[model samples]
Target: MSWKPLRVLTPRSILPALAVLLVLLAGAAAHANKPVPFGDRVAEPGGADASPVTAQSLDTAGLELKVGPGLEAYDPATGEHAWSYRREGATALYLAMAGEDAVVLWDDGLVTSVRPSDHEVRWHRAVPGLAEWLRGEGETGAAQRSETQRKQLAVERAAIALYTVPEASPWVAVVTPGLTMGFRDADGDLRYNDRPAGNCAYDPVRTVRTNYAVLVPRTCTGSGSNNHQAFGGITGYRLDSTNWQLATGPAVAMRALDGQRVQIEDGPVLGSRVFDTKAAAPESACGSRTEVFAAVRPQGTCAEPVANPGP
Candidate 1:
């Protein structure tokens, strides 16, 4: 049987196919070994007071932040240390992102903004009367030393709140149990101080931030009895100005919801009502029994409270 001459494979005909296969394989291998966007990890340094209250991936800035007793930044792609700030006696309570910088609120009532790129401090401000309060020297009246101690403990245990709207010029708000302070992110200058009206003393129970406003649920106590007769209400402070208007009256609890809305549980008579933080307009929830206090997102999906978990 005369078999046909064996066909000869030419290098020119097979080279192109081989090259294409190699290129495809190379691409797949590269993709498989590529670093994930937010998969970088870092361990807390030794002697940390508590676990990080906030861990954020600053993808645009190539940094990752972990805030607790101090603030630390790392390279998001490699988990390498970028910079850190630790005060001798201060503990960080809350953190917020202001444009490209990180705003940290210390337990000692100090607010600072730092650039994560080079660890440069943009600006720092100590809240008025906070140092004295921390030292237990701000108390007045004829209460015993133990009662002053109790008040000091309450002040130390008070919740801290931070708000920042990312923009070309961000707006930052720092809320404490005694005062609510706002700052312009561009210059870090004090913009507004929403102090208690008249003789009423402000005790911030909770705070939530929206794109346009900061909603604070405060217990305003009258001047008598060492300002112990307190009532609850919700106030919305505009981020752009010093104007703040009351949102709800006699609320026992307040919560932040989606769509820039806040849920206010009135003092039994009005039940719970949800309202827009920007416009102070109420949203009807009918008779639904959804627990508003349990639904409040104090950190707005970014940061979590370092202190009390429930209202």
Candidate 2:
């Protein structure tokens, strides 16, 4: 499947556990989420002399720039380290280009936007992960956890999703259950902390992040109709600016067209779907609300229907 892991089906008994999980997140999330308070609290890299270059590139072939330990930038042609950024226990997870800057996501849930000119971390924030929420609570304490338990936590952690609006544009989004936040690419400011859009199910795996929007599966939680697989529709949350603005899209995304439009591709979708709770099914079925979908679009989706959002 294109999704990471945890597309699961559990007995209804798990609902109580899931409820507890959400409660735990509500408190712990607030405590663990710490972004750059004043933007400059985190020291910036000094001038060229402060760089970590072991040696200048002797080869003239012009090698590719690579990210190594601690998000270090190196020239593959000569093994020259141009610069490096590191956090004690954090490990670099992935790196993507945000215009001229490089945004790095760390395993510890920290997202940093760095300027390539020098080794300046333009802005950064720790987006809470599922692991953080469940870290050291009553039944989920670390000391008493088993290997299997840790693996399960890791799998859930992997489920935290992200979406960068407009491809390389600076605005980057991070999503975890019960919470969502957006970090601006220009100066590392985070302005969003709610659903990008819609009343879609809370299943993170069913959500797809695109360059400009996040498409989430539709559901009628307490209503009385079973979610029609294909017709459930989707609520797209676009990174319109300081926050996620609600928008609409097809049930499934087919492909991107020439400009701001995308080619619709899904089975016939009738009027809005009606979910029947009395149809009789495990609450766990909600976890698999929608089918698998590809990752975020490289070029993003249609342009935001709204204009420039404020800081």
Q: Which number leads on lDDT? A: 1
CA deviation > 4 Å runs, candidate 2: 1-69, 130-160, 167-169, 195-200, 203-206, 209-211, 218-220, 224-233, 239-259, 263-268, 271-311
lDDT of 1 by residue, 1-311 (tens): 77898788899889999999999999999999897432222234343343554443344377777765577766677867665677656656557788888887765667788777666667777787654444445557424567546444533432345678653268787666567788887788887887765544454445666666777776554643465555555667775554555634544676667647776677667676667655545653433344253333233343433776677
Best by TM-score: 1
| Model 2 TM | 0.49
Error of 2 at 188 (Å): 2.2
Task: Give candidate 2's whole-model lDDT.
Answer: 0.49
Per-candidate Cα RMSD to the true structure, in Å, reads: 19.8, 24.5
